[model samples]
Target: MPTNQIEVLGHAISNGKGVQLNLDIAKLHTRTKIQVPIIVERAKKEGPTILITAGIHGNEINGVEIVRQLVSKKYNKPECGMVICIPVVNVFGFLNQKRQFPDGRDLNRVFPGSPRGSLASRFAYHIIKEIVPLVDYCIDFHTGGDGRFNIPQIRINEGDEETLQLAKVFAPEFIVQTGHRDKSFRHTLHKLDKKVLLFEGGKSLHIDDAVSKAGVSGALRVMQHLGIRDFSKELESMDAKIKKPKVVKSSSWIRATYSGMFHPFVKLGSKVSKGDVLGSISDPFGYFERNVKARFPGYVICINESPIVNQGDGVLHISRD
Candidate 1:
């Protein structure tokens, strides 16, 4: 790899150029190989490279759509930096319409993976080895997993000022300061001194048009703030509004007490106080009802979209100061 050239998915993209390439990961039981698409837009001048990854979980399609919209419509060879967009990271999960790999592993939880590890692990290793080392920033898009719906928001590591500032540029409705989890892409990138912003919106396996719109605009705003895109002239020309996303330091999930049909009273983005009646769970016969209350004061960031839930199922996610 030279200073003026970048290689991805076996394609060498030189300065002032863009290319769509594919990297083959492995051969399935059917002897068919799986490959992921990669799009790189390199600038002619010296600047940073921002990596935008989506669809790590196959079911999280809103982010995938957002990346599609950006790369297809909004992206250009940056005036300064470069843009690397990988619209679908998990080929198996996306094809199977699943959140986890066929082997029951969460791809997002297997970062800096082993080259000779499981399918998910190998994919993670490939990204860490080939992609993560080349980028200065990362914007990973996601949605609420397991039948949950999330308000459009940006999730960042706790107390990271630079990344926090970038998240602010996106100006989603909420900015969550969460601790880094083990084997997560954000944590791994943080360890390498690369700032990664996790954008959470919509629901798994479904597309919300409004959420998609928000996601697309948020990403453009981030690029604008980074000097990769023109904000006022271009965004305003498209009637985009940049609002300040509120920051919430703490959050918790409300779980079901027993298996039943859950009827949620509060919706996503609803503000709640301690002991607020968030929802109710009842048996099929209308007996054995249990009220799910808010344990602390916070705003509702995520809610279960599915009516049926099992005992100990997370129904709502709340965020508080």
Candidate 2:
């Protein structure tokens, strides 16, 4: 396949160039057509095709910003192969600033979707048809949803050497072995035998500058690893120092046992020992307080930012050390 010439959304983008195209997905109640933005950059040299996708959950804006920072500059365009970036996949949910589609469906759960399915499924189906087949690897950006803040991390299916190495090259604080649902994009891509790395950080609907910066740099490193650019020169130019992430096979979320005003003692990325007090939950009147403790030795990867919590709500997520 020619790396220089590529077609997307009925438009042909040629070598050493870039193009922004709009893909029509649906119509609003007011009869306005909703078009998803796609940016394609093809290099003059042949190498690998990588897909950078974001905003699968519309409330997660960090990924969107990461994508923006990546494609904003002219020089950042690949020197070989091609880069196809979809900054916001859930246009409807993004506009509404919600996690689910207008039909109340989680878009990420329905992938390689059906044409006759719900709006989310149809939109996903279109993306799988149009984008998935063209890419050699995929990097899906995400963040913790529902008031949870996560340390910058990479999640990949365990035992896939190619994908694992790609995740390592990205160099997040942790590399988690996570299983995806049957209809998820990750699962579908794995079924098609494509290498995938899912990078996650910060929180939904909020931006952490450090996490955003890390995301952009990690993606560039992955591009370098794929031979999209000169490796050592690119790293030196980027001032990128690679770190080996702690690889974990499993993790757990600690749930709140008492409903009240919670005060956290540890922030994201805090290391903790088994049975250490993580936080305190007290009544608004300050009559009594309950301590939330870690169940095992690990590092806190995610914490609930919201002070108010109910019984049985997930308060913290730990990746075992």
Candidate 3:
């Protein structure tokens, strides 16, 4: 493929510095069209092509912010190779502040999509066809959904050697060796022979400065390690370590036994043992109270921030080892 070729589907630019591309999507209205924003910067010399994707889930604003800051301010002028940043992959959901698209589809779940399928499926297909093949590695960013927060962590396949090394380069406080689900973006990328790192932190619709900063810094560190940039002089060694993350083969939601006000005793990232009182559900009238206890030892990766809760509503998510 030519470096600076522009097609009806997308526009590519090669300005000696690098190549930037903008992909157009199928339109619903004449005036409004959804587009996948992509910017690729390839240096004069040869190097790795790293894909940085954010907003896979529309509500994950921290990742989007991190990628924006990275491309516009940090990696605008690169030392070598290419850095491809896709700031918002799910524009429809983002506009409405919803996690899934109006079509009631989770874009992340429909990876390696089909060309002649549903709207979300077509979008996913275009990404796999036009983007994934051009990259050597990838970093997908995400966060906890509405009313939930997560501690900064990197999730990668346990057996992939290159992925494990890249996860360490990310320097997140926790390295989660997770299993891949069918049709997930990470799983699809792995099938395509790309080493993609997943970073989860903060919460939806909220800005956690610490999470955002850590995300950007970690990305830069990965770029540096890949020989894309030389930041040793200007950047300090991060204190982040690769701890044996609380491994959870599977997690279940803790539902409220009764409807009432919720008062969480523990926050995200806190470890809890079995029988620990995680929180309490109390009636607004203060006549009745129920204690929410952990059924197993694990980390509290996500908790409800909303004060109000109803019977059978999910209150906390525990990931057990």
Candidate 4:
């Protein structure tokens, strides 16, 4: 729907106005109220409404940082459409630097959630019911779970030509064609016929300057592409150069064979050939070591940065084709 008049978090927002609302759906066990701030900005000219969200997983501070930069730099203020920024969607996880809700549930797995379900589910339900309906397209930011560091990339389903095209416009380092999680926000939005660009970058609990730049620049490019605003001057000022994104059709993870201290050898976003030495695992005392080689040729998009590893732990993510 064209964004002229809309209501976000129960407040009516008219054209050319901005409002900050709190999604105070729940409180902590300490009885202290926690507010998930939702920032909404609408242009006088009616156009598509785009929802920019991050912090679905509380530990993914890189995602939160990306959205924060957008809001802080006023990049979310569009000239033709409505822009909604939810910098911290899962405040509970963010506050504790955890990955799940207070009820120990991953919020991303509970899309279109039940009002009568878990804490995460109820919050998810509210998001879909109250905010998502007004959104036309969405950019959900994320980062690698655990300690895996992902290069800047946009994840989309293989056949979504429109979203794939838009992902190209975002100009991240990579575009990964991957299936959606069963009940993820991306899947739910897809079911509702809303296009979503799921961006993955950096790692959880940490923020990288390059990744933040990529995330912000990509959003600017998307908004500019949609005619929501002209970011010509802003784009010129951005330091992260537009990447010729490599569309990854398939990918796989390189698991550690022997539990030991892990070290990755290849640079992220670089192509690798079969049998290449990607990394090594060794005993802490330097008594045992094993070289991890690439099984097939692909690009290294993610690496496990943790210094320790276990048997069968995924240490690197490489594209198959």
Candidate 5:
């Protein structure tokens, strides 16, 4: 509860000061040192402490960009509380452009891990031991896996009204009410009574300008709402189209019935009626083709951008009544 005892990576950071520390835990097969940089900023006055993190899945480039922009723009500097930004958590995977650690483990699936565990587990354990205790709230950014492109949305556990309100303040196109994944970073934080907003947008290995803007604007808005800083001028300049996030209580995937070239018809976050043509699949040759139709009325939250898909592949994610 002491304000003066703010230490990261064993270095003390006094009030009204900022520091850049590195988590150097492992080495590559070639003995190259990979350090994960963590940026910290604090205010003289005491307030909530929030940690902004990205790249749990290293190939999620848009998430990394969002946190990077926050640090480069000095948006992480708080006027009251403390702001900790870890732009890329899985430096190993990041360097290799992979979604998992070098040891073939998903960094997100191993949380609050053991020191003697696998490479990813050790990294998770270190983070939990050295950093997570200091955080009051967290915003973990991510993009869809593989070729799935997700509309900007905030995902939180159902029945957490406080977190729901914060998601509302984030103002993404949709707020997905979902259950927590076992051993996920969000799940670990939730157990520690830390509020976390899991942001999903764009797609792995690619960055979209609209997704970046949505992410940055949402973080600024959340920070302002938390009284960490005032971003009125910044937000106004961005001219972001802040949506009253539609709370998605339930959703379902529309899978492909045929295998072939995939072409989507509707835009991201667009609403459609049942039986609408969401996309089409055709054989590489002109021999076969089929149109995919919606089974229910809802907003399209995700679209598979892959040029080719197999039968039973989930081509679109739509909200359900």
Candidate 6:
């Protein structure tokens, strides 16, 4: 409840220029000691504390790059607030280019975690305890998981007008009104009345420059809108306008019926209708091929680009009407 100063990693710094600190892990072996990295920047003025986090799933590199570019820029001095950027929340998974933590846990799924639980859980608990309470608004960045690709989009909890408005300010290609699942960080923050916007773009392990630029611009736009920054000259020129996105109540995955090489007929962001051929799965011999068709009309928001697939593996995702 103090205005002039805040404590991060047990180090108190008066709110002025900005500060960066690493959130230490509970047990640090030489191999894992460097896993937790959280950077906080508090402005000299009193304003809303906004958090920008990425790499909750580890392999989502676009979000990581977005945070990097945002913090590196010399913007209008934060006149009224602070910006906390946690570029890599799951460092172990990132090292191996995996989606989950080293303990094989999906960090995003386990939120408001227990300090005495597993590694991922403890990390989550520490974050909730030390970081979540200090922020007024949050924006978590993400991308499609390994083997999957996504069009740039913002996912917000349905019916939260403030969060919706914030998402619109980001102006992503799509705005998905989704509900929170139990134990998600977004859900936990929502319980505390903090509006957190989740942005998803590109594919895991790959850098999509377009998405990264858009993401950084989006965050700056929000900052400008929130009065953290004075001007939008930097953001105004970037392509951060809201596009009417396809709204799906839910989405379903199209799985491979047999093991084979895949040929996608549509790319990410392509709109499709019922009975359209989304792709084809062909046998190694090329003697047999099965057409993958859209079950309903909607958008092809995600598709698997791995080229090889096993039977029943997720191949494509459609936002159904």
Q: Which clashing pairs does model 5 show?
A: none
| Candidate 6 root-mean-square deviation in Å | 2.1
Q: Residues 201-295, candidate 3, lDDT per residue (tens digit)?
A: 88898888889877887887788898888866544554443344444446667899888999999977788999999999998887999899999
Question: Once superposed on the true structure, which residue ranges of model 3 sit more than 4 Å away at CA?
Answer: 1-16, 237-253
Give the Cα lDDT of each candidate. 0.86, 0.86, 0.79, 0.92, 0.93, 0.81
CA error at residue 57 for candidate 5, angstroms = 0.5
lDDT of 4 at 137: 96
Give TM-scores for every candidate, taking all chains together and pairing residue i with residue i. Answer: 0.94, 0.95, 0.88, 0.97, 0.97, 0.92
Clashes of each: 0, 0, 0, 0, 0, 1
215-261 per-residue lDDT for model 1 (tens digits): 88888888877887675676777676777788999888888888999
After superposition of all CA atoms, the RMSD between model 2 and the true structure is 1.7
Q: Which is the leading candidate under lDDT?
A: 5
Per-residue CA lDDT of candidate 6, range 1-321, in tens? 357678777878676756668887655345547547666666777889888899898788889898888777755247777777888888877777888876788998888999888888998998998888888999899998877887888898888888887887877777787777989989999998999988988889999888887788778878888988854567556645546555455788888988899999897878888999989999888599999988888888788988899999898988875
Instruction: Give candidate 6 misplaced runs (Cα > 4 Å).
Output: 28-32, 75-77, 239-242
Q: For candidate 1, what is the TM-score? A: 0.94
Say what the RMSD of model 4 is: 1.2
Q: What is the lDDT of residue 297 in candidate 5?
A: 100
The sequence of per-residue lDDT tens digits that candidate 4 reaches over residues 1-321 is 445467788798888999999998877788877689999999989888899999999999999999999999999898998999999998978989999988899999999999999888989999999999989999999999998999999999779999999999999889999887899999999999999999999999998999999999999999999989999898897765777889999999999999999988889988999999999999999799999999999999999999999999999999998
The candidate 1 region of ten consecutive residues with least summed lDDT is 1-10
Which residue pairs in candidate 4 collide?
none
True-vs-predicted CA distance for residue 272, candidate 1, Å: 1.1
- What is the alpha-carbon lDDT for the whole of candidate 1? 0.86
Taking the tens digit of each residue's C-alpha lDDT, what string does model 5 give over 223-246? 999999999999999998678889
